[model samples]
Target: MNINDLPAEMLIEIFTYLPEWDFLRNARHVCQIWKLISTSPILRQNVELSKYMDSYAYPLKYFSAIQLYIKKLVMHSTYIQTFEKHHQDVKFENLKSLHITSKVQCTWWPNSVFNNFFSMFPNVQIIKITPEFWRDAENCLYALSQFSIIELDFGYYGSNSFGTMGKLHDLHYRFIQFVQCQRSLKILKIRASDHFAEDTVAQILEKCPTLTSLNISGAYVSAESFKISTNALALTEFYMKSQSEFKDGDLEALTKRAPCLKTLNIEGCRSITERGFRHIALNCSHLKKLFIGELDSNCVTDVGSDVITKIAKACPHLEFLSAIGCSKLEDDCIIDLTSSCGSLRGINLNGCTNITDVSFFALADHCPLLNVCEVRNSAISLKCAMYLIQHCKGLTKLNMSNCNNIDDKNDSELENMLETQSRNNKPRTNSSVNSKLDMSSFSMHCFHSHLKDLDLSESMHVTRTLATKLTRILPDLISLKLSISADIESDEEWFQEIFENCVCLSEFKLSTTTIQRQDYLKL
Candidate 1:
């Protein structure tokens, strides 16, 4: 059908699928009718309109003409001066989001520049400034008191041990005071230099009473050292990472404080023990997604398994759980989880050595819809893996890195099984049905043929022969990661042959000593 013949609504639906507005420019050139439709107010308000305008312009083009039109503008050190030169015509009025990463020299200037730009944009809602622009940030915060800014992301670029200094203590105090006074800020993400003091965080939380989402990933805030004020009762999502800073009793304290939290992630918090996890489960009963990482063997042996098992029992509504590197977590805990939490959909247990392949097989047996299983650095044998491949058909992503037991020997056994199955399916009169089935080809098929993504990195025993064989077996494989494996006997020839054979493969990683990057690049 001609472009003009298609209904306008249907055309709009087609246009929605295109990520950039620039597609409309080409669409306009198609005909006069399309040009008129493309310029409509509705089309001009395309969600990704800025992306369209950006495609044709240099990083620093006529700043004034494009300034007001830009919805989300990210300014690195190079383009900061460009925007500063056209500072007046460069209206931040239409800018819904602004991210400025300036150099040390441009700090003072960017602040005054934004002070002018932001004052005109009454609709300015989200502002993110790099640490280089912190001085400018404080100025903008002070100047744009009228702005209804809802989201603020401040990167770490401060001086004088910016992470640990008490300079932010004053800013926290003022920010909280602003939160109490102002009405628009609902999401606050602050990446302090290193670690923040408890009093500083408390001050900020107390002021931002309406805050629903808070992420302090880079900031070194131990559960013991940092405390959220009671005002954080409204919070629905909280992310805290304190793996580098080891302070006792912090996890327990933090969980107890944030009772209303529905999505809690305490990744790399090594000090968090069973007591801390229990405290979290007891307090945050509403939590639907929990991420607990960096767990040591001792913690898992002591109470880590029990902590997670009990959480599964308590949080019946939990949908996603990522407890990677918790080496002590065993098969029984997983069995208990699948039995208790029927709502669980995705679980990532990478580096949980105590879990064998049976853990995955059992999880598949119990959980009807397990989609993702990442069991890297475990000792799961080939038997359980085959069981998982057969049983967990719903799985999309499977990581069996370091499971070298799944080699040619295992393939031989699977071929034997397929041979037996094929023999049983043979008919007396129609022996041709047996030939049509291609039992020899069935012997070559891997147990998991439907897998789209497979990561077998660091499996030292895996050879090029087995890798190539497996790729052919799983024809639908899209992403394959086989890093740090044993080198191919004839590297150059083997790689070229493998790449040519694996037609469906898109993302391939064969780095480390097993395969040089340059050698792989040659393919």
Candidate 2:
């Protein structure tokens, strides 16, 4: 097929997948036809007028040319001055969505900025307001009355500290009063607020009938905080994190409330245990993604793993499961999970110390389609890792960092050998060894041929030889992470040599080591 023979529609579809419109920056100058397509209104529909646009003198004048094409416009802090001046005149009549984000301080915006900002996009369907554009409660209430927004993301920007002032309740009430009138709101994500509308949940239920995903994670909402009406029972994905009063029965009760909820992320509820999660598995069997990980503490014990086993058996469609810091999960739990959930795709068992080689064997025997697996800071040895590499050939991302027991051993040579190879008494061949004495050829040559992202950081086992042996065989490796393990002898050249051999290495990280940024330039 000739390069220029493809139709314009097909070419436009291909261009949409290209990385950040880089090709068009110069390709527009290639030919008249290309330039016309590049500058067309259809291509410039979702334009972002960010701080980088300051590089141009008159961004407003530039945007005015494509006013008819403006569908989604993102305005950052840099465009604030020019925005405030000519926003009323800049007419994007067909604008459907508007995104406003900034990392500037709470007091950065002029009191009238948001009021004026909303007036500019009065009829936009979707409005995303980052926490940076905060105004006084009085100004906020009057300014937002114009927008009939369907999707609203009024959340945090890590800037505002919702202080524990004497008027805390007043602040909550004011917030509710401001947003309660948004009857057409469909999706609401409120972040970094300790109090999620103790009294306003009913008002929201009344106002927003089509609410689907409610992320009150930053609100610090408790089991007792919400007074959800029956009208608000249509939520699909509900995420509530960092609750002080979250108890064990919340899930059992929550399933009854949001019966159709597909994804649940109750992350930091210290009071929740296996009992509630079991109920979640039994009742909310339609769950696709469950994140009940106790990030700060190892609160989700074997009971939680047991509940997960129930979830695997009951909810076979569970795609992504994260149990980070659930330390008590042993090999049997993994066995049950792998056996029951043939659909298991990605699992994060980081910080689970009780898991070992047994889970690896079970996963290898079952779960052929499993792709992303992270077992960092676990008791799994490198010998079992040999089984994983050879058996779980489909895995794209594998993280076994901090498995200190995985010392520089070629046990994987025999450990990972196929059953047929062992019966014939044939040793694994290492034909492509550049130099027999090369330290890179120390570890077993080629095992995980399909792995793209590998993290062996903090494992004293991956010495100079093992790193070389591992890198030589893993031809598909794109991103690699390595850290200096204790007592492992290595020089700067060894590190350089390992990287030089990886012709496809795209993302590299060498942490807690003497490797300098300049060494990367050498490769």
Compared with the true structure, what per-residue lDDT tens digits does model 1 show for residues 1-523?
Answer: 6766899887776665655444434765777776566554444342332322433334233333344555665545444444445444545556687665553244546456655555545576887765454454455556556677798876655665545356556555555555566566778887776534455566566666677888875665544344434323577888776555533365555666667778987777666567667777677788888888754322332336787888988887777888877877888888888887766778878768788766776776877566777777778766666566555556668788876665665666456545554465532121334432443344433234456787887776666677776665444566788764445565667666555545556446775543333455442
Residue 504 in candidate 2 has what lDDT?
62
Candidate 2: stretches off by over 4 Å: 1-57, 93-97, 103-112, 132-145, 156-184, 195-197, 201-207, 227-232, 296-304, 390-394, 414-449, 485-501, 513-523
Candidates' TM-scores?
A: 0.74, 0.77
Which of the numbered candidates is closest to the native, going by highest lDDT? 2
Error of 2 at 371 (Å): 2.2
Decoy 1 TM-score against native: 0.74
C-alpha lDDT values of all predictions: 0.62, 0.65
